[model samples]
Target: MHVAEEQKPAKKSSKVKWIILLLVLLLLAGGGAGAYWWFFLRQPPAQAEQAATEADKNATKGAGKTDTAKSEGRLTTLPPFLVNLADPAGRRYLKLSMDVEVNAPAAVKEIEGQTAKVRDAIILLLSGKSYTELAAPEGKLLLKNEVADRLNQILGAPRVTRVYFTEFVIQ
Candidate 1:
C-alpha cells in the first residue's frame, strides 16, 4: 500500500510537470506572435503624423505661389463607390473613396465635369474585381494604375498623375 501511494504521487507530479511545460511553451509562442505583429503588421502612426506635418508645411510654402502654380498639384476627390465584388458568393462588397491627382489644374475641372462617366467607369471596374484581387498590396497598386488609366481614357489625355485611396473597406 505504501509503494502504490508513492507511485500515484509520482504519476501526478509527472502530469503536473507536463502541464506546466505546455503552459510555458504556449506563453512563449503567444509572446513571439505579439512581438511580430507589433513590429511588422502594425502601421506606424508617427510616420503618418510626420507626413501630415510635411504636407502642411508644403501648403504654407505654396501659399505665395501664383494661382496656376498652386493649382498645378491640385487633387479632385471622387464620390464614394459601393459595389458587390465578383466573388462566387456574391455577398462580399467594397466601399472606396479616392482623390485623383492631375498633372495640371485644368484636369480637375474636366474630371468634375465628367463625374458621371468617371463614377460609372469606376463602379463597373470595382464590381468586376474579386475580393482576392484587391486584398494584397500589389493588387492595390495595380488597381491604382488601372484607375489612372481609366480616368485618362475618359479625359482623352494622360492627365491623371496619381490616384490616392482615401477610404477603402471590404465587407
Candidate 2:
C-alpha cells in the first residue's frame, strides 16, 4: 500500500510538469510573433512622416510651375463660331456655338488656316449627338475633350487647353 501511494504522487507530478512546459511554450511563441510584427512587419513611424512630407513638396512644386506658366501667357482664347449640321429629318439644320482656347501659337495659326476643315469636324461630331446628350454636364465635357483632341491632332500639337460653351441651344 505504501509503495502504491508513492507511485501515484510521481505520476501526478509528471503531468503537472508537462502542463507548465506547454504553457511556457505557448507564451514564447506569442511573444516572438509580437516582436516580429513590431520590428519588421510594420513600417516605421518616421518613414510614414517622410513620405507625407515628400508628397507635400511635390504638390507645392506643381502649383508653382502652373502659376509661373499662367503668368508667362501660355494661355490664349479663340473666337466663338457657330457651326451648322445637316439634318436629314427636316429642312432646318442644327447649329452649335462654342468658344475654344488654344495655348500654342502654331496650333492657333494651323486652326485658323484650316477653319473649314475644323468647322466640318466639329459640326459632324455635334450633329451626331442628341439634345439630351449635349444637355448633361459630363457629356458636354466629353464633347469638349473630343473637340480639343481632334483639333490638336489636326494642328499637330497639344495646344488646346479648354473649350468653353458660351452659348448652347438645340433647335
Candidate 1: worst 10 consecutive residues by lDDT? 65-74
Candidate 1 lDDT score relative to the true structure: 0.92
Candidate that scores best on TM-score: 1
TM-score of 2: 0.49
Q: Compared with the true structure, what per-residue lDDT tens digits does model 2 show for residues 49-145?
A: 9878778667978787543443121333444544443455534444455666777556666777888888777767776766556668898899889
Q: Which stretches of candidate 2 lie over 4 Å from their true place?
A: 1-94
Instruction: Kindly give the stretch of ten consecutive residues in candidate 2 with the minimal lDDT sum.
Output: 67-76
Residue pairs whose backbone atoms clash in candidate 2: none
Q: Model 1, stretches more than 4 Å misplaced?
A: 1-72
| Model 1 alpha-carbon miss at residue 3, Å | 54
Clashes of each: 0, 0
